[model samples]
Target: MSQAPAVLRGQVVDAETHQPIPNAQVGVADNRLGTSTNDDGRFVLAIPPAYQQARLEVALLGYRKHSQALPPLPGPELRIELRISPAALGEVQVTASVVGIVREAVARIPRNYPVRPTQLTGFYRESDNEPDGRPRYLVEGLLTVFKPGYQQRGDDGEIRIQQSRKVDLRPAGQLVRIDWAGGPFITQYGDFVHRRAQFIDLKHLRDYDYRLAPGSSYAGRPVFVVVFGPRAGNRRADFAGQMYIDQDTYAFLGAEWHYTAAGLGRSPNRADSRSLRVAYQPYAGRWHLKTVWWQTRARLPIGPPLNYFGEFLTTAIDTAQAARPDYVERAQYHDVFLRNAVAYDSAFWQGTTTLLPPESLRKALLDQQRQQRADSLFRPTTPSAAAGTAPGPAEPTQQPDNPLGRFFSRFRYGASVGAWPLAVARAELAVAYAPAGYRFGAQTTALITDQALTGWSRVEYQYELTRELTVTLATQYVFRQFSGRGWAAGLSYQHNLRPRHRPLYGRVGLAYTCQTVGRQLGTFTNPDDGLRVAGTNLGADRLSLRLQTQADALQPTLGLGLELSHKFELVADASYLLPLRTRTQLEIAEESGFFLTRSSATVDLPAADVSLRVNGQPGSTLPWRQQHWLLSVGLLYRLR
Candidate 1:
């Protein structure tokens, strides 16, 4: 049986300007099925029979929301005029200079933003397109984001993916798949408003130079347009764009920015270009994120370009906690990758509001299957080793076997040459393998000295107990010509914190240590005994617990770490390591003046003060006097 949908026609326009407001959202209040207006501010909503009598809501970012009762059946166009929100009209004086307006906005964030807890329901989408802008992959998710409070230093919000779908459209022989797994996750962290100071803090005002453009209107509200770019003396400022600010409230209405020339050098992640546009609106006396759109184009060293686009739109807001936080927590969500998102009944998405049209989605899926079939016929079933052919490019969203990859990608090889405390020059080499939650790795270091190589080699293995926990076992052997020859073994558990700006971690450990100390000339247990033991080294054993954490994201210039041990004391350390410059070298040469050529490349060399450490440990020595500070600098070059 089929029921005819009730057609709701409407035109959304600015109340004062009488101009069409494009892309305004319109739908039945409280329902997921909704539609957006076109460039002409015209919308046609086909409401189901169940919602025919419901109220139709029209909303735009900067304008006041409007609602009206729907007719019983299909109706003629109902005109909707949205006025500039009264909340946006404030007593704040207008500033002719863009810099002044931006400064005021940054200063007023704590005041104008929501102070109490709030929850938001929104739709998120990630799409991939061919060079010609043909859609190839799409994933849509309905998510609930819970914010602790605006005044909080760190965002305690949680993003629960309520429902989601992953559509694959690559051809069979096409080993390349769109990077879709972490798209949603990236968008979640892309909430720059929550991380107030990270992108545009008052302290970083010097990084950007602002210019005031002519005033304009957005959603019927008067706006001051500010054009910004890197400051004359600052090369690190990598963003250039314009920001629209509400004239009366000094609040940000919208902004669009793209990577500048300097930014391209910092990102060697194949991101040739990147841009984002964001908008905010006042809802119930508190400002809220209305929309976020991010686009990027990645070009590999030897492949066609891959384009990625992601968007998030807030459809509803609940300041009173109407919806329970029953969904999965950040830890649980972090453990699951979006690439593994399960498919659901078509009825699932049919009930939800989405940006991608159904017809377009189906066509993309069919195209993927068609391309896969064509590729399967040409691609060899097995990989070739004799031909020295490298494997195809790994999918960007592919998950590592280790569950930790859910939080961050794992590294395979790394090397660092820096100075160690008491050692003028030292270098380290690390090779690790972590798959399926089992980890094995070895690290060795050598201290360059006048005598000989002196350092330690450590081998470790980790067994993932769960998504947030891991069991680790390790052993270390120290090598020194005239120093203590010893070995240490330990067992520990590491837990990674979740849903926060700064990476946090805690570990509880137990260890047994032994060191062969030089023996005294004579040693005897019994004073009166005529026997004495001599020329033998003494061995020592001990057990201890250690807890440590690093907070770098919160304060880039200064980082604090603390380590405590049951063996008797606490060790506190502070460090500052900032990169001065990042350099890259590319070289090309002809091999025997023929088609075959020998090649090598080095990508980045970041110079930083890698050895800046100030530590205080009262329980470290009997005399309570030891070296507590060390500073050194080094340059690290990549080799592959």
Candidate 2:
């Protein structure tokens, strides 16, 4: 058995002002294990037995780095006071031009950042809120990120969600919804240095005007502050921001940027405002991304504006053991981190150091949980049926308490009407149940036209790869009004293009279907005499021809869904089926009809052995070779 790890609790504050320092980095010297102080400037760190003798270190921007021997395990909380560095106390002089300093910093990017692969462990949190600052929901996760160093171009990196939990704070009857896309990956994409953002890109230097601002400090070192914005008459430039560079080394330390009026004008969604901040920490002779904070606000079509906020805090870094994540572990760029998150683990969260949410959000979350508990208390309970007693009055079924059970118990049913673009009008009804990451469903469709009627019943299984992607397998039975039937099997994949938090979402799908269909052809009539012709007639006008064929097709589909409320959604889908290959078989049938009785005879014939003509002209042997298009619109109701 392994020994229990030692725990250290501490608070970091300024030596001169005695004020708490938020976002301070605390760790063991030369070790990969670390944590950051919360908003209260408090931190808790766990040290393994092997590292108990190592020194504890604390560092924050504009302060002097402090280190001391580890105190006894289980001791009282320690208070650490860090003094302001002399350089940051207005003691350093800068004589270089602002533009030159920024240029040198951009040029040294490859040398300042890691040149090889590196891994970082961090905490990610995102929140959705109303315009009035009421919290709607919050998602938190532990993430492991792997990235190719700055020397490599066009490589963004990979993220693996280790664990996560979501808390919904919306009150009962709240119908509005809002969410962010790309989750923690948004922070990765926001890394200005890694992405070579326009502001820092050397090629765009002439488009911006830069001026030296007041001096600042970061990571216990003085930094040169440079403020920049788009130059006059530069309509293409859309950002205004400040950059912090280390005074001695000229290495880029941090940046804060926001969209200017010109930028907001170019936004496709007409965002009211957007801003982001990124900071880097120096360790082991290289700089690593330390923190990222982003916020955005946009007006809704029918209500107040929605606000989104997200942050990522790196707690540990490892360069020696850095490697790419396996395919199953790597998160897709469109994946919603909360949907792909692992179940919450209380013990793990208790031991982890994470940024705490604001007091208002925490209180809202608590109230939500309390309401859930209060509601649960009034749920009616039923007696066991195996007690050899008569059944009691019917009552509403209770929701399952376990996560897996609850998921399986949830269901959705929908009905829709559509058309095949002048070919056939159709109505469809569908139902589905989800047990975990996968779902099982069934749908029945009816098609009608002036000349024919058709019905299709299908059973489908779908597995969710991410919140926005799903793979489907289905088998279907098709029946026509003419006493004809067929069987089909297909595989398809669907990807949602819109964020889940939006009221409107769009998706695209691709499928391959193989099917065989048999249908009876109406009796042939001679055009010249308007007389019926029989093949092997038991009686005139009673002879029927049947056609059976195999058709394989590739289908592409586009769909949209609009949330009507918490439990209902309106959906529409359109699909085009392109036939790939077809094989035909023909048969001749003769029927004898009597009062309340009928008899039929069928003779099979090869397509090559039979000849068909229409309007005195030869007809193609492959009759079911045409492509088809289908469209449908429906309403879905969720039941749980």
Candidate 3:
């Protein structure tokens, strides 16, 4: 048959420096046949049995280029030299998946590998030759998100728009602030999304372990090849593809990630094997993504897209009282300050950023209830309906895990729409009930601890006008599974909070039903309408005041709330909602006076962009609660 080839020889060099790149990429491509270069950047591979003409490739990250072809018979003591180069030039080659270059040149991997490979770094080592030519750089770009209606997790993963600030580098390797004032960025910051300054030089990765993977190469030079494995805290993460570094100067031609998070038009993922290819131009000293084609599969969390489901607060001001009445409103604050999307209001309590008191509110309300049971002294922190301080007196029947609000809670005004139909959108949950089934004179429906799960909810828009709670009109649209389409409208008054924490604050709304309750034909049908109008019965009008509060004691998890509702007809109101929990309620009216009623325990699947709540009817139509009760638990990740 065939005998193993004899003399084996190869040239080795630095993958970056390109000049006699050395000291790496020894033996065979895999665990097959391989050898490293000597001090002279050269290696001899005495072919083992059964191999043909082959050469060894010397490689390393942020170093000189690697030469693999072999010349005639180069005896042992092969010569090989490695040229060191700067890391983080205009381009950086890497992989989205936890990268691992297992050769002796590289080591291990970490956890939570990157989901997307949009991360880039730049290394600036004063090129003593010419300096001023690299001051102002330009990076034109385009980013497309997943289809508007992808089946997988979307809305929360929409394509994002950004214009990031360019960072400046000092050869001394010192921390330097960027020109923050001149970003003129196209993107805004928020709890849900935003961008960062582009400049984390790779120079640091040089003496580090891992080496490049086999079938991978760099798109640009000095920045040519990059080697990496899982970092410290990146296990259990998905691995993408390898990045190609340029064989010349350290610069970025672009990236080649295994998974692409962006898409074209509304097309779902066309391929499971994602790849992100980019086109960049070198500006002053920076490189930007000019054109990028990001591809990935559907049903995955991949984006920074047009997110439309966060929440905010609003207030109604009575300008008649203040000399300078500002109908001021706040939109997407998550872009600037995450977790601080509290809607703006017009009342005294508006504009103040406050942390949720997970414990105090509950204690205060419970203490009041004990006093009422003692038949002892009477306390009046606030008047019942006197209009002075809303938190008049401690409520005797304060609810634990309640959503209707403690004693007194008032809200400013401004959910109303101006130019756009959306005044404020958010993720929420809610529950409804009928006690005595009447709006005005009916008794509220809420029992001990009972709740139902509805997905994220929406709150309607309101505007500030007067000083008192009497604003001309308060309109709101709530997204629910109502008759016909899955939405309802509501209109109501401006409610306020007395500064109590238990179920912090809520809203009081009213809805004039236009049509009667109908059915939802979907396989997973939820409640379409609560009112199945009896024949000849005029459509019913609803009235409610719901309260929902966050429990700081359980930060980063768990949400709680309560609701109190009434229908004008008295016998048509019910209220009690707990997600993945039980709901017990009781209804009362001017006629029946009071009575225990419907009770239901169910699971609540969170919704997309609306706040869930139990509040006064909105739009004179069925509406969503202003405060969200749609609590949920899950993991969060970005697709950038």
Best by lDDT: 2
lDDT of each: 0.49, 0.63, 0.27
Error of 2 at 351 (Å): 1.5
Off by over 4 Å in 2: 1-96, 171-176, 265-270, 354-640
Best by TM-score: 2
* TM-score attained by model 3: 0.24
Sorted by TM-score, highest first, which candidate order results? 2, 1, 3
lDDT for 374 in candidate 3 is 26
CA lDDT, candidate 2, residue 276: 89
Model 3 local distance difference test score: 0.27
Instruction: List the candidate numbers ranked by lDDT, top first.
Output: 2, 1, 3
- Give one digit per residue, the lDDT tens place, for model 2 in 1-640: 3678888999999888888887666777443466667767899998888888889877654566788999988789999998987656442222224555666677788889988889988877787778777656667778888978886758988888887766655554334334456778855767888888788787887788876565667668867677888988897677899888876566788899998888889876578899988988888999889888888898777667888888887778898857687655766655555455476664575466434354533432334663354233322334754565754533322222455534532445556554422223222211111112212111222222333434444444444445445565655445553233333333333343443333576757787877656555545421221221223323333434555556677878788877664456677878787878866655444343463443343333332334444233445443233338766677766542
Span of ten consecutive residues with least summed lDDT in model 3: 565-574
Off by over 4 Å in 1: 1-96, 134-136, 171-181, 186-189, 197-199, 267-270, 321-328, 331-337, 341-343, 354-640
